[model samples]
Target: MGEKGECSGVKPSDDEIWAKLVPSDSRYSDVEIRSDEKVICSEISAAFGDKHSWCKIIRNSDLCSATVENKSPNTILVDGTEVHNENTVVIKDGSEIIPGPDKGGFVSYRFDILSSPETSQRQLQICVDVENAKCSICLNIWHDVVTVAPCLHNFCNGCFSEWLRRSQEKRSSVLCPQCRGVVQFVGKNHFLRTIAEDMLKADSSLRRSDEEVALLDTYSSVRSNLVIGSGKKNCRKRAHTPVDDQSDGTYLQCPQCVHEVGGFHCNNNTVHLQCQACGGMMPSRLGFNIPQYCSGCDRSFCGAYWHALGVTGSGPYPICSQDTLKPISEHSISRIPLLAHENNVHEQNITDSCIRQMGKTLQDVVSEWIVKLNNKEIDVTRLALNHVETINARTSVCCDCYQKLVSFLLYWFRISIPKYRLPPEASAREDCWYGYACRTQHHSEEHARKRNHVCRPTRGSNM
Candidate 1:
């Protein structure tokens, strides 16, 4: 009876046993885990025992991590414990595994973690067509391609400049070559030029000779940005071009290029910025005491531009909405954005209630913080905006950019205050397990804000 009971003892399958075997110590540091299905260490295999199957690893769905299993009978140890044949041990990120017994010869493999799918996949070269990159007028790969609006046709700078010169000489209006509509605006398409160059580099046969390129360079008129004048269809009168405005040449000129604007006329060398929002041109007047360009993106916005000139969009050109750009002092926010607190709605709600309980408005809190920011009372060493070194309350920014700054500042404000100082309702909550890394933060706002998310594991956590 005893012998039968010993022989009939249940033996677990390798898959079943490995399924339940999780790593005793799941925290591994100083090791790199690979993405491959199996990474066998040849050095360890050669030094300790057989050259194959000494140590094997696979994705363990149960643990959501890689697991190391012993395939040989000789000896294997994970950390300091011995793992016999068919016995499995889960491997944590940055953990080390030994292929042989600790007494004699052994080889160690460090398991590393791959953070994202982008990092796991290898990059490949992108192919482009040379024929599609050619200019319609020149019938060749574009040499500094310029885009003409309204018709939305593309042409080489040299070819379009020559055509414009001829049209100005013979007709009252400059028209698009393909479609005879009066050209309203034209500018060099930097993006298309880059593609054309790449196509040429890929196929040298498509490149033009040096003499041809040099000749084209001479005819290139689309320099900086050009603001075309309005051509009257019924009136057969030639409009006098702006002073120093030569045909087929590039120069910066606002509406003042042709007429006086705000008692100022644009000259041949006037530096201008193209409004990113409206595509309108404005003189770069740093002395005008108005914000024309966004310090964050360095792009021009027309809101402050038009306001400073005491004019609106009723003129020939367009004007952007005033709400797009304004002085920081003029900006106001009544409700916190849904994106605050890493899009943790519960947390945002708590933050809101906490403010309300204190008898303060959102704007009031932000105003006080902004004053702190300008006074250099808070360290902006980690500001996440572009040109962080130059950005401050005095720097005018776009609406979207201003929101980002406010969000960052609010984060510092929330994390700096003592937990005990928080309203009683917020002070009693426990921190979440994942904290900032919680995946539920995006889907469940309540879970994100209900718990504290900024604590690390306490020592002896496993014990």
Candidate 2:
């Protein structure tokens, strides 16, 4: 059943396609971020760094990230600078799927912030679909479902079905929606319904799973956060000791064990809890920049001084601040070059001699036997040097003048003929049997015999 005189066009959604293409159990990889981020990605230090200074992570934080692809899309340079890296995208849609007419496009999230980073939070957000961003079958929008006619145009199903009904009364096949010519596909609503159903089922399942999983993950994370909160509270309660027990202001004791352990010690204005035995340190409940350590003798001191650490700098290491240690030795580098640069004119002189031999026949080869230079027993360089012009002229020279002019020129230059270079396609069909070709090889032999020339290599010889 074909639509008569009807135009055909339909487009399907990405969900419809992925319904069949993607596995059900597959979990898409996503960038996991937290509300309380502790990392700060510093700018590249190109001025101070020697070469390739971009490192993956910086500071004491392992979680914070700074990369090109992660940048917001509108922040993208109009100069078409490609920020290459997966998960480091500027596209806004949040999904990594991109679909197009022919096939796939991954959708990425991007904020319109690159242009005004300071005000980026105030601007509207945009998502760019990038991966597998195609679908000739569907119109390719995840939001809308459009029918794809065999003609490959995407259109609304309602409009297309009516178009099909109207077209069938006049012709054998449906015309393209835009072209109005007989094209394949019987325009029907069933196909559109089927595609829509596929999309709905897939999207529905994904949405449900996302909602359920998100809540569960949030619950787990919240529980862990609660645990940390509880630990911090318990540590605070255990951090105190009695001032009445210590006779001198120089000492403090743990309230729990009544031991002369690191506890909050009061100075004139500042308060710091330090374990007297082991040098464990913690900040007092009051303020910042206070240093304290456990007075415990054997066990490693617990780090409670982080509360007082200034955010402007790295936390003080143990030896310097109670729990951190400095490296024993530092790394060093030396810059001695392996190769020295020189003019090398002495060796270059041997090379320069070949250029002088150019355009000159073998004066030495014609007179005396030559010795080996690099390894070839043939004086090819002298042969090439002498015959260079003739070989170059062979292509442009007239066929009739080839023998007389070429032969006379070679004889004057006393150059040796190395090989018979026949014309293109002519050599495949036939050889010059009776003409100048036969005389040329004969002249070469005669020349060779007259010189009693045994081939030998010489300086600057190539081939």
Candidate 3:
């Protein structure tokens, strides 16, 4: 009665009455109708729409994980950012498939998102959304969602364009849709423009866009001109300082915001350094920088110091909370790591457990470099500086090749250096190796240049 997938919202005794048929004109470009009798679709939306329709009519085809593209250039872009690249694939959903934008974006790994390998949580997709660089706005939420840019704010497309066109007639510029910064440019990364055009063409179901993004560059410059005569206001409310606050004399913070407070004003880096006036430390790390602009006042806060926002411990500062609240950042982000030194070595690269695999299949990574050095194909200086990484891994040397390698190491020592620096009263192989001095001496740059440290098997580690 109500097109193919439904029977007039009445109880259909058999699924044949309804359920098996899909309407010809679908609203979403992201979906496909594989069957004429019934659209292959997810049961969730289908049942919710037609309550009386029998549940059995919902098609139960397991969409195979396959990559698809436009048969010709007839390939319409479904969603600009969704399947943005030529390599993007559509995981089949029963007979229904996400329709177009059948091209764009490269893929790192094939994941069974809908029903296959559930290795990743469903939330992982949102992480991909945040990282999309094409759109510069902050809240890039699409499907009637928007990202705010220039002002770097997001508003619905309709909301933004209406706001922009109307606001242009009267004032120098309007405040941002979200932040209220005097607006300037939305730049080229206009996501709403893309979304509106694609949705209209595709006959989509996503809601309407609201507003455009803009930034006020001139305000800061004019304020810079006015800084000499501007009056300052002071609020007497004192923020609660924890008993366990660090002894660094940082007591001043924003009572309202709790970020760092500085000389009669607030600064962004107050997270790292204590406020000169109020002694409050602000937030610095955690993927966020300074917050000089306050949402309360259109003007930036100039203070004795900045506001403090973080909870502190005697050891390391507490993990910042701003990112923890977001669904995507919490689950998808990797922690900031320490600065890796040039000589830093990981334990996984070595260890007999890795080297002695089920049968120790030959891997020539380490051996190839050693052979190159022995042949003098490259410079010795680079070889010495780089050898640390290659040394730990097991060589691909066969028994015969291993013997030749051992001979080469010995031959290298004999030819390159005048002597192996044996003890005053001991042999090069005995006293030098047993001494603690050998470990220190051989590992140094100068010693490495004189003798190559090639991996040489000695009858299966008997040495």
Q: Candidate 3's residue-wise lDDT over 98-124, tens digit each?
A: 223332221111111122122123323
Give the residue spans of candidate 1 off by over 4 A: 1-254, 267-272, 284-289, 421-426, 432-440, 444-450, 454-463
Off by over 4 Å in 2: 1-150, 186-463
Task: Indicate which candidate wins on TM-score.
Answer: 1
lDDT of 1 by residue, 324-432 (tens): 7876667788888766666666667667776786789988888888888877787775455666776666778888777877776666667776888677867887665
lDDT of each: 0.62, 0.26, 0.29
lDDT of 2: 0.26
* C-alpha root-mean-square deviation, each candidate: 14.7, 39.3, 25.5
Greater lDDT among 2 and 3 belongs to: 3
TM-score of 1: 0.48
Q: Cα deviation of 187 in candidate 3 (Å)?
A: 18
Model 2: worst 10 consecutive residues (lDDT sum): 222-231
Best-fitting candidate, scored by lDDT: 1
lDDT of 2 by residue, 69-159 (tens): 3222222221134332222332221112121111122222211111123223234433434222222323332222233334455443434
| lDDT comparing candidate 1 with the true structure | 0.62
Query: Which residue segments of model 3 deviate by more than 4 Å?
Result: 1-175, 178-234, 237-265, 268-312, 315-463
